[model samples]
Target: SKFRQADFNLDPLWQIRFDRPLGYFAEILSTIGILGFLAYLILVLVALNKAMILKTEILIFPLLAMLIGQAYYYQNTTSSFIFWFWLAMIAGLCSKIKENKISFILNKETLRGRIMAFVGIIVISLISLFGIFFISRVCFADYFYKQSSKKSVGEEKIVLLKKAILINPYFSGYYITLSQAFLNNALSESQKPVKDNQKIFKLVVEATNSANKATQLSPNWVMTWQTLGMIYQEVLGLVVGVEDWGIKSFEKAIALEPTNPVFYSKLGKIYFAKHELDKAKEQFIKARALKPDFSELQFFMSLIKEEQGDIKGAIKSLERLQVFYPLDLDIIFQLGRLYFNQGETDKAIIQFQNVLEINPNHLDGLYSMALALEKKGDRAEALAYIKKALALSPENQILEKKFEDLKN
Candidate 1:
């Protein structure tokens, strides 16, 4: 009974210790499972060889079961490898059976066996060719879809996405993306003085149709409904009555995904456009509660405040936003205008200065700064700032008049 173990002399490698003992047990079981799987594979291979020799196809059932098991266990691995391996094995077996049959037929009657072999080869070749073409179409469609995202030019992106849709019309995302591109192009065209109303209208119509198609194809998808709502509100609104359609689409989106703040914001914007200030405020408040850091929601909240004739409330909202986005020129300029309206000339001038510091060539900022200086009895500096703004926009008749008046 008398042999004592020397624990102090044991090396770290010799110690059988596990911080997570269950993990160690699991790893050991996994190793044992793998070994068992290897043994099963060897037995199946042996059975397959024996079946082949006996000209019995019964072993195919067990082989297929093994394939199913492998697929289930290794779903994330390269499935193509398994597919090709199984295909090759089946091909080899079929060829072997054909060879044996051909040999037996040729021994009895050579001409019939030769003709059958030729027909079989031609049929297989045709099937393979069709398979390749179908697969290539799918692959090319996926490639174009990916390439569309990499394109910086809107037209090029639209072309690539269209090609993808042409190849794979079942994919709803392609139509949605193409709709967005058309919307962007239409917006760009609308801003030009030499606008093609017909062309813009056609673009908007196409965007609307595409967006509608996407929604129809994926009726349950919230994003598709949201996209359709955007198309109705932003693009179709330029040509037709959009309130009902836009509201319905957005409501559908909200129904599908009630927590999406963007959908609520979009609904609020529609109400805002209709001058339904209370409804707009309700939606905006809900959006703000859901996404407190969202700049657009905050900006819209300030607009609502201003529209409600609460200038001080609007100013406070913007000031709160400035704490998060201090360098934003739009916020700075809006804050300056609010301050000027409240007769806080000094604060207004400081905000305007901040805007000019961020963007020296800002036309509105320069003109506003000049007005603020003039209000403060700094006529010379005000004139200087106006001159700078005039130089930047020399073709503006309004600025030219302002400059002349200031000089007089």
Candidate 2:
């Protein structure tokens, strides 16, 4: 009775609020448990069958990557987490296979063993390759890959990958993979100012050549073009006077994959930087058409439109952006300004209110809200808001003038 009574002092609502985090944790643990069980069952079955049939089976690195990847994906589902998880799973599988584990499992000799063993191997290989493809896509999109510098570990990976490619160099992926390693190294080295540009430049050219080879090997591979384009763009940005070359590279990528929103969006940025508003808008609109849900593209379009003196068009684009990312502070602030520019005080006030609700300390929101109140003849409320704005931005002369005017 005493023990039970002692356990009853917790607040139920506090416990309920705590449950949400616990629930997420439990979900992650449950997923991991299920994957681990599956691995155990599969490995055990393969080992037992090998023992019985006097043969070993290959451990499917790809399948393991997939299983672990799916588990991790469901665990956090973020790109970075997924990247590291997939990376680890792939490297682990490759390491295991390099140690002859895959062959050990697949070499099993049994009437029933051969069928299921090959099936398992095929399934696993597919998942691993898929993981590699997924990782490659991310690398193309972000233009970076993170690899550890532990010589033994990373060398093992490189060696294992080389071995895999040797077994099948006809696959375009082998070239992509080799390119990724170089690209990753180039990226890491590029960040270190002390690192020699000549060395980095050599690596970049090699990476570009490899990526181009991959594209040549598989012309239909959309990812290859993208990667090659990114390499050109990033490396050229570092070495000045390569804008013409960079534009050509982007054009090649666009030609290869015209429908990719990211490709168009990136090209649009390049065009915008070149002061080619019409060309920039063309690419941005194409990107918007392809992926309407891409809020950032709309924002870019808005910026271009505003630069071109199309305030109404800019406002429309911002409105569209607000729908997808309502709490984006920049979007909210921009929408407010756009409305204010058009002399629509009521609409501007609503937009400012939204910003203040999301971020009470927002300087622009506070100042605008105060002005809107003053315009409506609510002197007392307006003055109070002005004081609040001034409190947030004591150095602002505009707020000081408004505050003094209100007092007068």
- Give the worst 10-residue stretch by lDDT in candidate 1: 1-10
* TM-score quality measure for candidate 1: 0.62
- lDDT tens digits, residues 268-367, model 1? 9898888889998898888777666668788888988999899989999999989999999989999999899889999999999999999998888999
The CA lDDT at 360 in model 2 is: 91
**Which number leads on lDDT?**
1
Please give, for residues 202-277, the per-residue lDDT of candidate 2 as tens digits. Answer: 7777777778888888875666776777776676566665455556666776665454566778778777767789
Clash number by candidate, in order: 0, 15
Q: Return model 1's CA RMSD, one decimal.
A: 13.6
Model 1 lDDT vs. the true structure?
0.78
RMSD of each: 13.6, 18.2
- Colliding residue pairs in candidate 1: none
Misplaced by over 4 Å in model 2 are 1-169, 193-196, 241-258, 306-323, 326-408
Compute each candidate's TM-score over C-alphas: 0.62, 0.39
